[model samples]
Target: MKTCILTTDTYLNHDTGQGHPERANRVTVIIDHLKKLKSKDLIWKKPTKFDLEYLAFAHDKNYLDNVKDSFPKQGLNFLDGDTIVSPGSKEATRDAVGSILTAIDGVMKKDFNNAFCAVRPPGHHAEKQKAMGFCVYNNIAVGAYYLLEKYNLKKVAIIDFDVHHGNGTQDIFYDNEKVLYISTHQYPYYPGTGKNSEKGKYNNVLNIPLPAGTTSEEYLDAYEYVLKKLKEFKPEFILFSAGFDAHEDDPLAQLKLKSEDFYNLTKRTIRAAQLSSKGKVVSILEGGYDLNALKESAEMHVNALLEF
Candidate 1:
């Protein structure tokens, strides 16, 4: 299998100051561990510069201009209470969006079978007009639009396994019939949006809200519902909002998933979507705080991607 890892060092400069869970070290640790693998099967690539018009596809024009003006020279600027940006964040945020777009191009051109983007300043929480939950431009959302507009793909499915609900991704595609957004996240949690009833306008959104202490068995059981939904949609392309914070070791969430569970989750998803998608899938980093668990869980997810 041709598997690529898309990333860049600009993430290291996206400083969030001291003690922030979404710090630069998060991606650093995962990249470091991945380097230890040193497998010839893995191709490392950097995010390519993309047209800013793609940003307008996922975010409001005014909001895009505001984000452009929000980057501070010396200090950090906060888009929301938690979403912080510094001088280097300008490039970091763009790269975050670029990472997914680049990976999509590589997959579409058959340069790689699939890819995992390990970029930072994680997106999935940024709505069309606002940033929240440490997310800026909703990178995956733009990638979905890229598939829709560039490849003219009619059906695109975004499966979010992040610990927190992808409130922004749902917000962006709630009314679009071409895309299906399904997420299994901890509910009654921060941002507090993912109710089982918040289906999209086209019924394209499926939010499976788990309790605070959901176990692996329970979570996987719920994931079966996600698989069922994917089977029905028969998407031509799939994007994973891959977050590892659901692990028991993560400090941010209460879910009790082990590292190996990610492998099972990813494998199940791939098998379910392969026939319709022709094995075209791209995954990007979202939320995973605990360094050790994040590293292990990411590797497991990639392992499945490779084997499948």
Candidate 2:
């Protein structure tokens, strides 16, 4: 059982314009760094072509139609103040979604034990009808729906370790009992949504909102609660909204997690849910700004996936 790395070159075309933190180079650095490892334990793969109806699993019909129409014919178009699209964004966005679906199919079919999608135009912030926070479509949400609808999965869990809260993911699964969405993020920060009190309708959502300047020790300590919750839920499948911007080097937020923290937390999460999930997991790129930090952290994350 190997770990798969799913990605495509289409992400290079989803231009965000100049000086944007969520640039195409984010995935470039990660893919470049991972390739340097030359690890035989990794199975490199490209995202397979998938049905466009899968997008509707996460987004509204009108919203999806609007997004399809919003892609520019030549230059750039803004989906929101921060979420931008270009001529190539049409392919990039669909490829981003396709990457996850392909990864999910691989894992479910045992072609790989797990996967990490190094993709741009990161999802997790796009809500049911609105695109925000450098996200156009909720990729992981659609993956969860695919698990339920396509694979007939009954218990699915999403762990979001991004610096900013995944308000969009929480919004989509708020009332859905079969899917559990947990997020640990710097609160009262950008987007400002991950309060501990914002549990979902069926109490399926858990938000561990930490204050800025939280250190590696403090963040890991808080992560124990996440593990405890996972143990209680005993999910059948697990998905990670892997984000590394919490690294101290990241200019995005003030959380002080080191690169190795991702490995430790991921190892713990995999170990904690081993019995229920059978080591079945799929991770997708979300947010990580500092190139060096993102590179180091994503490598550490993959190391954990390779190990377990």
Candidate 3:
């Protein structure tokens, strides 16, 4: 089965103004690089429109409404200091969420073995009622809800590898026993929420908070905990908040992981999830500032996905 690459063109219009780190080029770099590969096993697809009601399952209805009203007719509007939206952001935001929903449907329908969503307005930092960290809609959180509500799946696991903790995703699933959220991130960092003590109510959240200078070896060792938890939970589906800022080549954070390490980490993850998820996986872009590291690491991650 081919691996699906889900994306859309509206991301180019998100327009975070001049010189924002989370600029449109982030996804553009990855998508352009992936397109260069001459692999026939890759299936490229655009995100399809989805229902607004499903967004409510992951965020407050009022919050969604406010977000809808917040889009500016022109220029940029800030949901918070860092999260910005422009005239095109309305469609860009929905398309980001829709990319993941479409990827999930493709995998579930067996149109592909697994998938990756290359989108922006990077989520996982946006909480149920608030947006932060350049993230607006907690895309993975919505996908987890889709698994439980639409597919009737009992267990779904979300693994986040962003250099920053996925505070928003944790907040959304903190009380939901049906989903397990795991993160490997830089502690004492931005958003400042992931800690060893911040386990979910059902003990479903596992956070492996590493220091600023954490090396490739150290990070991989810590990853064993995430795999162990996944094995114990035995999730019926898996979602990845794939962030490459952890790469040593990245500028956003201080972790020292390499590009190939992403390949190894992804390979190990899919292996561990084989029994539980039956190889059904969907990853979405999160954060990776250095364009070179972002492109190379995303390709390595996709290399692993293709291997399976």
Candidate 4:
């Protein structure tokens, strides 16, 4: 089966203002790079509208309402200290969530063996009632909840490899045994939440925190624990909070992962999914600065997905 690529033109409309790292160009660059591949097996599609009910699975009603009400008539409004929203941001943010839902539907229906969502305002840091870290909604968390509620899937795995920890995702699923959240990120970093001792109430959360200036070899070595945890959990579906900012070129953090490292990570993660979840995987964008590194790393990631 072909791999589905979920995106929307609305993403370009969610302007992050000048000098912000999470600019609209991130998704544009990824889309442009993917298009250049000219791969026949790629099935590109725009995201469809999703019911607000799906979003409620991960976010609070008041929070959603606040986000809806916060969109400025013109110019920009800040959702939090870091996240910003313009009038266009409402549609763009909804489209980001829609991209994940559409990707999930495609995978569950067997329309594709796997899918990749390249939407932006990346969603790993938005918690139940708070929007932060350039994230307005917890997109992947909602996708996982949708799978559990709609498909009755008993076990799901969320693997996050962003340079920064996915604290919001962990917060949403910390008590839910059905969803397993595993993350590898630079320690003492932004938001400062993922600690080795911060295992979830049900022990469903696994965090592998690497120190600053970690090398590619060290990062992969730590990733083995993630692979082992996923294997042990044996989930029915796999969700990836795929972030490429660990690349040495990224301005955000101090990890030194090379472009090829993303390919290896994808290969290993795919193999684990094959073993535990029949190759059912949905990868969503989280964080990645350095346009060249983001483009190259994303291409390598999709190349591995296509290989499967």
lDDT of 3 by residue, 1-308 (tens): 59999998999999888989999999999999999997899999999999978898889988999999999999999999999999999999999999999999999999999999999989999999999999889899999999899999999999999999999999999999999999999999998999999999999999999999999999999999998999999999889999999999887799999999999999999899899899999999999999999999999999999988
lDDT of 4 by residue, 1-308 (tens): 58889998898889878989999999999999999989999989989987888899999999999988999999999888789988889998898899988998998889998999999889999999999999999999999999999999999999999999999999999999999999999999998999999899889999999999999999898899988888889999999999999999999999999999999999898797687699999999999999999999999888888887
Candidate lDDT values, in order: 0.95, 0.94, 0.94, 0.92
The total of clashing pairs for model 1 equals 0
For candidate 1, which ten residues in a row score worst on lDDT? Answer: 299-308
TM-score of each: 0.99, 0.99, 0.99, 0.99
Give the local distance difference test score of model 4: 0.92
**Superposing all C-alpha atoms, what RMSD in Å does each candidate have to the true structure?**
0.6, 0.6, 0.6, 0.8
Query: Backbone clashes per model, in order?
Result: 0, 0, 0, 0
Q: Model 2, residue 3: displacement in angstroms? A: 0.4
TM-score of 4: 0.99
The list of candidate 2 runs beyond 4 A from truth reads none
Q: Which stretches of model 1 miss by more than 4 angstroms?
A: none
Per-residue CA lDDT of model 1 for 134-177, tens digit only, reads: 99989999999999999999999999999999999999999999
For residue 243, model 2's alpha carbon misses the true position, in angstroms, by: 0.9
